[model samples]
Target: MTTGSATLSAATRRSVLLLSFATFASMAAQRICDAMLPELSRTFSVSLAQAAQVVSVFAVVYGLAQLFYGPLGDRRSKFGIVTFATLSCCAGSLMSAFAVSLDMLVLARVMVALGAAAIIPLSMAWIGDTVAYELRQETLARVGLGTTLGIVCGQLVGGLLSDTLGWRWAFGLMTLLFGVVGSLLFIDRRRQQAERLPTTNTEPVVRPGFVAQALIIITGPWSRIVLGVAFVEGAAGFGVLAIWASHLHQALGLSLSAAGAIVALFGLGGMLYMVVARQLIRRLGEQGLTLLGGSLMGLSALVLGFTPHWLLSLPACLLAGFGFFMFHNTMQTNATQMAPKARGTGVSLFASALFMGQSVGVLLAAGLVDRIGSGAVIALGGGVLVSIGIFFARALRRREELMRLQ
Candidate 1:
C-alpha cells in the first residue's frame, strides 16, 4: 500500500482501538453494578426495587441519549464529542463510588450511561466514514470485541472485588480506570485540534430539520425490519444471558465465582466469532451469514433451556454468543450503510433498537420466569428468536434476488 493509504489505515486503527477501549471500560463499569447491587442495597438499607432503579434509569438514559448523540456527532468533531462524553462517564463513575444513598447511586448510574451512550454508535459512524462497505463487517466484529471482552472482565473482576475487597472498591477501581482513559483521550483531542488548520467561510455544520430527519429515518420501510431484527436479537441472547446468570446461581446454587466463570465463557465464544465473522461474511454474504447466525442462536438457547446441566449450558452459551455476534455485526453494518448522510443517526437508531429490545426482553423474562420458571421462559425466548430470524433471512434473500433480476 502507498504511504498515505498506510498512514490513514494506521490512524483509523488507532481511533477504532481507542473507541473500542472506551466501550470496554464503559461496559465493564455498567455491568459491574449488577453484581454489586445486592451489596449496595444492603449497605444503603434500601429495598432491591429501589436499588434496581440504578439499572433501570441508566438503561433508559442510555437508550434516549443515542437519539441525540447521532445528530450531535454529525454536526461536530466525532472525536471531540465522544471524548467529552467519555469524560462525563468518568465523572459519573467517580461519583458512584462515593454515593451515600440509593437515590444518589441511581443518579450516578444515569450519568455514566449518558456518557457511555455515545461511544459505540459514534465509533461505528466514524468507521463508516473511513472504511468501505466491503470491509466494514469484519472491521466492526473487531471493534465489537470490546463488548465481549469487557463483559468477561467485568463479571470476573467485579465478582472477585465485590466478594473480597467489598463492592465499593469495584466501583472505585472502575472509576479510576475511566479517569485515566478520559485524560488520555483529552490530550489526544487537543493534539488533533492543533494539527487541523482552519479553513475560512465554512457553514459550520449544525443539526438540520430534526423533526423531518427523524421522520424520514424512522418511517422508512427498512426501519421496521431493522428495528424488529435488533429487538429480537437483543431479547434473544442478551436477555436470556442476563436471566441465566441469576438462574444458575439460584436454581443450581452455584457460588458467585462459578457463575461468573460460566458467564465469561460466553464472552470467549463471542471472541471466537469476532475472529471469524468477517471471513464468513465475505463467503456467505450478509443474508446467508445472518440466517446461520440466527439459527445457531435459536438452537443454542433451546439446548440450554432444556438441558438443565451446567456442562451442557456451556456449549449452548458458546453457540449463542457466536450466533449473536454474527447477526449483530450484520445489522450494525447495514445500519451504517442505510444512510450515508446521517450514518451516525442510523447507527444510533440501530443501537437504540437493540438495547430497547434487551430492555423488553428483561422485563418479559422476569414475568415469564415468575409464571413458568426460568427454563421454560428461556426456551420460549429461543423459539421467538428463531421465528424472527427466519422472517428476516427470507426477506433479505428475496431482496437480493429482486436486485439481481432488475
Candidate 2:
C-alpha cells in the first residue's frame, strides 16, 4: 500500500492510453441520448417518460451483456475482445445515426450498449493483470482522465451536436471515433501478437465454465458485498443523473444545450480529482475519501434540488462529478481485486451489477418523477448516496483492520 507515484512502463502506458480512447467513445455514446430526450420526444411524438426508454433500454442490455463478456475475457484475449467490441460499437453508432423510428433507435442503442459493456471492465481487468493492487487505484484515476473527459464531452458534445446539427450528428461523431479507435487497437493487437513469446514463468489461465465462474464469484463474501454496493450506487447516483438534462430543460426552462453544459461541469469535477488523485489518496485514504465523496454528492444533490435559480447548478454538478469518481473509483479498485484469479469475470459482474442498478433506478425514478417531481427524486437519491458512502467507509475500514490482523 505504498503512496508514491507508480510509474507505468512505456508499453503499459500506451495500451492504457489506447484503451482510454475506446472508453471515451463508449461513454460518449452512452450519454449522447441524454441531451437528445427532448428532441426524441418531439420527433417521435412521445412523452418525456417514453423518450427516457432510450437510456434505460441501453443500460438494461448493457448490464446483461456483461455476463457474456466476462467469461470470454477470462478465457480469451481481453484486448482482442475489446478490439472486436470497439468495431461493433462503430457499427452500432452508425446504425443509431440512421435509425428511422423510435424502436429502431432503441434497437441501435442496444447494440451500442452491448459493445460498450466490454470496454471499461475488460480494460480494468487488463490493468489488474499488469498493475499491483496497491497502485491500482492511482493507475485507474490516471487512466480515468479519458473517462472523465469523455463524460464531460459526452454531455457537451451530445448537447452541442443535438442543438446545432441534430441528434443524428452526435451518433455520427461517435461512429467516426469508434472507427478510428477500433482500427488502432486492431493494429496494436496484431503487433503484440507478432512480438509475444511463450514463457514458462507465466501461469496458464485455468478458466472454469461460465456458470461455474459466475457462481464462484457470486458466492464469495467480498464479491457479493462489492457487487451489492455497486448495484445500489448505480441505482442511486446514475438514476438521478440520467434525468439531469430533462430536469433542467423542463423544470428550469433552460435550453437543452444549456442544461447539458451545466451538467457537463460534473466531468470537470472528476477531472479535478484526476489531477490531484495521488494527493487525495495519500491524504484521505479509502475511508476518508469515501466519506468526503458522499458528503459532496449529498450537498450537490441538495443544492440542485433546492436552488431557486438555474445558475447555481454549475457548482452542484462539479461537486457531484468529483464526489462520484471519488466514491466510484474506490469501488472499482475493490472490484479489480474481488477475484484476482478470475479478474475479468469479477470486474464484469461488478459492472453488470452497477448498470443493472442504473436501469432499475431509472425505471423507478421515471415512475416517481411524474408524481413527486424531479427535485424530490433527486433529493431522495442524494440521501441514499450519503447513506451508501457512510456504509462503504465503515465496511472498508473493517476490511482494512481484518487485513492488518491477517
TM-score: which candidate is best?
Answer: 2
**Cα lDDT, model 1, residue 126:** 74
C-alpha lDDT values of all predictions: 0.71, 0.85
Clashes of each: 0, 0
Give per-residue CA lDDT, model 2, range 86-129, as digits (tens): 99898889999999999999999999999999998998888887
- Tell me the lDDT of candidate 1: 0.71
Provide the lDDT at 114 for model 2: 91
On residues 237-340, what C-alpha lDDT tens digit does candidate 1 reach at each position? Answer: 56555566555655676665566667666677778888887578878887877788788878887787777578888888778777877777778877776556
Report how far residue 230 has shifted in candidate 2, in Å.
Answer: 0.4
- Judge candidate 2 against the unseen true structure and give its global Cα lDDT, from 0 to 1: 0.85
**Between which residue pairs do clashes occur in model 2?**
none
- Please report the candidate that would top lDDT against the real structure: 2
Provide TM-scores for the models: 0.88, 0.95
